[model samples]
Target: MCSSVNAELLVDKQTFTSQNFKTFNGNNIKEVNVGWESYGNLNPQKDNVILITHYFTGNSHAAGKYDVADASLGYWDAIIGPGKAIDTNRFFVISVDSLANLGVGDPHVITTGPASINPDTQKPYGLDFPVVTIRDFVNVQKLVLESLGIQKLYAVVGPSMGSMQAIDWAAAYPSKVERMMSVIGAGQSDPWTTALLEHWATPIKLDRNWNDGDYYAGSAPIDGLTASLMLITQNALSADFFNQLGKQTVPFQALESEPLHDIRKSHSIVNWLRSRAQARATTMDANHLLYLVRACQLFITGHQHDFSKAIASITAKTLFLPATQDQLLMPYHAKQTHQALIDSGKKSQIKMLEGPLGHLEGVTGISQHTDAIRAFLKQ
Candidate 1:
């Protein structure tokens, strides 16, 4: 089992704010505040630092419980701690919440998004927040590192949306990062992936209650938000996994209903998905989710026009770990990026993770590749 130095780590949330921040699109945000958390100690030279970015729905809590009584550990608690794969015992693992983070309502997450109040107008930013990109996430992280006097990174790593940030870090600051890893992710959002992301936001937009992203004063677009989450949950899984779900709950009840009178009825699996999304929606904001979707869709290494030139600038030894069954960010995304890195003569290697959970395997099945990660880090 993965364990922290103190048995179960009791971590605290810390805040980092950047003033007069300029976004990749030439937009200016007066202030950007994001929560961060750290595991292990920063060595004197600060060279032992390893930055781990969080996924789309995740916050900065990457490896510990916020309190002793907490019911669950961080999502990746399985392979990040004292003696685990990333091995916090010898390296300082740090993670920061990205601007437009989906978990904006979680008390543990400090992020500036559409849900945040604009100091100038004393109202929620709504759709007014500047369009932030993965490069902006990298820049915010860089500011945090500079604040702590950390100049060199031992490794920059993450999965899903986090992976995009990891790749951007290596490409943007080639001299500062030593190693990089992208799990269930790619270097850029291709045309296909970008189009697919639009579906996640469509349900929310279709909700009349959304009121064009200005629903903060009244009822939230719960139905739309729930549908969006359901789609995300489904897309993140494979047909192999989907078939196994709701096995005990009959496959179809709507079809068997008396007189076939209702078109609103759904299958057990649909209800199951809605229930899961409802549980998660309680602490989430609809606008924040929309912003995150846009941020993900706009991702590209170095945030430049020349994708080739940007990726070619990376000097960090790279490792790409793609899930064999992922349908969301398919394995080919990682393969394509890895091949480019190898062609450029950069240290790059690819590994496959196996599990039924699909894209989520990158989080739940990370432990299976402990040896591979340990070996890569050592190299």
Candidate 2:
């Protein structure tokens, strides 16, 4: 089925700007802009629309080739094409770059974050930018859709943090969102998950070069940013997968990287992770990562403090797809949320992705459950 997915679905980034947008916290941003991408066609009734919110590190490119020869495809290419689970041929698939998206340095990504110029001061917002929330993200997206005269959504789907947004949608807008597929999702950020998210912000703050998120004009916290990225990558991966890769670096092969050889030296695995992070960081901003972390840490379904009351607003037929070996969010995270939905008398289903890849399995091994997803969408 994956092989049957066409790689020819090319797309371009478009910008949406909402003026004097007031955040949920009562903070007003002069202008908020974000990039979005869409595939397939929107029917005249405007009812066949599916919004795919992206994961932590992902952008608006959910399923398409920016360029045909580009080596990488959109993150969910396998299930989003002509005859795939999402089947673009029959549905309009759209994805938007999140507020304070990490990919600020990427040419295709347009986001309003710490690095964007503050119109009032003629300089980058830096730390002056107001803190944002998951609610703000959904509101901005609502503005974008409203701009296109689109009302009501066929479904909202996402993975990880995106799943958080999807659930938020069904809760905050019960009458609008018809279906929701939350992959690696939870109903709320528990104390443990909240604490883990704090760790991601800590690394960026500890970097001496961070300057309290004012490093835009300076050297930038490359070290701290890379470390933060590495932390997220490790947390998202399974121990067995890391161990398998770590074994490739034997004692002798790690000689130069051995601390015995030099205090700065480290293992090949460490270097490999750092290198991978460095590549991603080139197009990422540290402040944006911090802001995004806080957004995630503050998230709860419907943005309500009461758990039971929060999910009470959901009217969508929901599906919870958790990675079987996920070490970061863990299967139990999804389980608790799924049980809550059932207890609340909401339509909900749970399915586990079986694989050794852990959190990554939801993306890499998703095709294995195509029938399940396809049927869920059909219903």
**Deviating ranges (above 4 Å) for candidate 2:** 1-7, 248-257
Distance from true location, Cα of 224 in model 1, Å = 1.1
Model 1 Cα lDDT, one tens digit per residue, 1-379? 1235457777889999889999888999998999999988888888999999989988888888988789999888887888888888899989999898887778989999899989899999999988788888999999999999999899999999999999999999999999999999988899999999999999999999999999888999989999999999999998878877645554644355632666776666777889999999999989988988998998888888888888799999999999999999999999999999888878899999999999999988888888999999899
Model 1 residue-pair collision total = 0
TM-score of each: 0.96, 0.96
User: What's each prediction's clash count?
Assistant: 0, 0
TM-score of 1: 0.96
* Tens digit of per-residue lDDT, candidate 2, span 204-290: 899999998777677999999999999999998898888877775533254553666788877777788889999999999999999
